[model samples]
Target: MKIILSNASSDPIYIQIVNQIRQSILSGELRAGDSLPSIRQLAKDLQVSVITTKRAYEELEKEKLIDSVVGKGCFVSGANKDFIREQRMTRLEEKMVEIIRESKELSMSKQDVLDYLNLLYEEEHTP
Candidate 1:
């Protein structure tokens, strides 16, 4: 597991850590039962306080993306399909909102924007 922190980001260090780990889980990079680094190790690797790393891990546990085992370590949780679908939809809606705003500013027709979307989607999915 790799995490990169940005000192320039407006978000706190813990939030940045949580977001990256969440994204990894959602993207399937971190699968169910995959072991995560210990809080102390993560703090050392990221050069942040142990408290910050613990906070990030706690948030992940709260979201059901990870679980902590006593005397062991944290591991990725088996995510619920419905919850995953909801998260995907939420992210898609956010992107669509941005696309719609940009299209309106450019005076593009709805169909034009949709056609571009389809093209981009196909490009990404093509082998």
Candidate 2:
């Protein structure tokens, strides 16, 4: 998997790493039981501090998305895809609730939000 970092992004470096690695696993690009680069190796490759990579790995481990073995290195968790997807969906639902509340505060109608969502969804899907 290739990880690209963006200096212009608002998110911290570790977050960017975590997000991309999470996407890889979720998309099946990195399948269950697939071995990931070692923390030191990834740190050297990304030209980032070891702490950054460790933090990113720690976050993934916290989500049960990956597992680390003392000597073997980190690998994608063996959890079923449906379970992983459900975990992400739960998080998405929570975020949507916050967004919906904000939309209501701004007097944005349901249709308005739906239209905007449709546009955004289409934009993401468009080639």
Candidate 3:
């Protein structure tokens, strides 16, 4: 797993770590049972405090995205991919609902939102 941290981000260091690892797992870049670097090792590699990585791992463990075994370090949990996808879809729907409500308040039409979204999608996908 590759994790990059940005000092410019508003989120805390631990949250940045958590989000990147979570995305990797959800995207299948980190398969179930894939071993993670030890907390001390990751901290050394990232040049961050061990506490930061530990907190991030703890958060992932709480979400059941990864597991920790005594003396064995951490590994991705064998979670159901369909369940994960469904959870992500539900969150996306909630966000879209809020976006739609805000767009209506701003007098924006569906076409306006679609155009903006398409532009963003293209920008992200552009080489």
Candidate number with greatest TM-score: 2
Count of clashing pairs, candidate 3: 0
- Which residue pairs come into collision in candidate 2? none
Q: For residues 1-127, what per-residue lDDT tens digits would candidate 1 score against the true structure? A: 6899999999999999999998888888999999999999999999999999999999899878899999999999998857967976897899989989999999999999989989999999999
Model 2 agreement with the true structure over 32-120: per-residue lDDT tens digits: 88999999999999999999999999999999999999999999998878887898899999999998999999999999999999999
* lDDT for each candidate structure: 0.92, 0.96, 0.94
Output the lDDT of residue 44, model 3.
98
Clashing residue pairs in candidate 3 (N, C-alpha, C atoms within 3 angstroms) = none
Model 1 scores what on Cα lDDT? 0.92
Ranking by lDDT: 2, 3, 1
TM-score, structure 3 vs. true: 0.82
TM-score of each: 0.68, 0.91, 0.82
Give the runs in model 3 whose Cα sits over 4 Å from its true position: none
TM-score of candidate 2 against the unseen true structure = 0.91
| Candidate 1 off by > 4 Å | 87-127
Each prediction's total of clashing residue pairs, residues at least 3 apart in sequence or on different chains, is 0, 0, 0
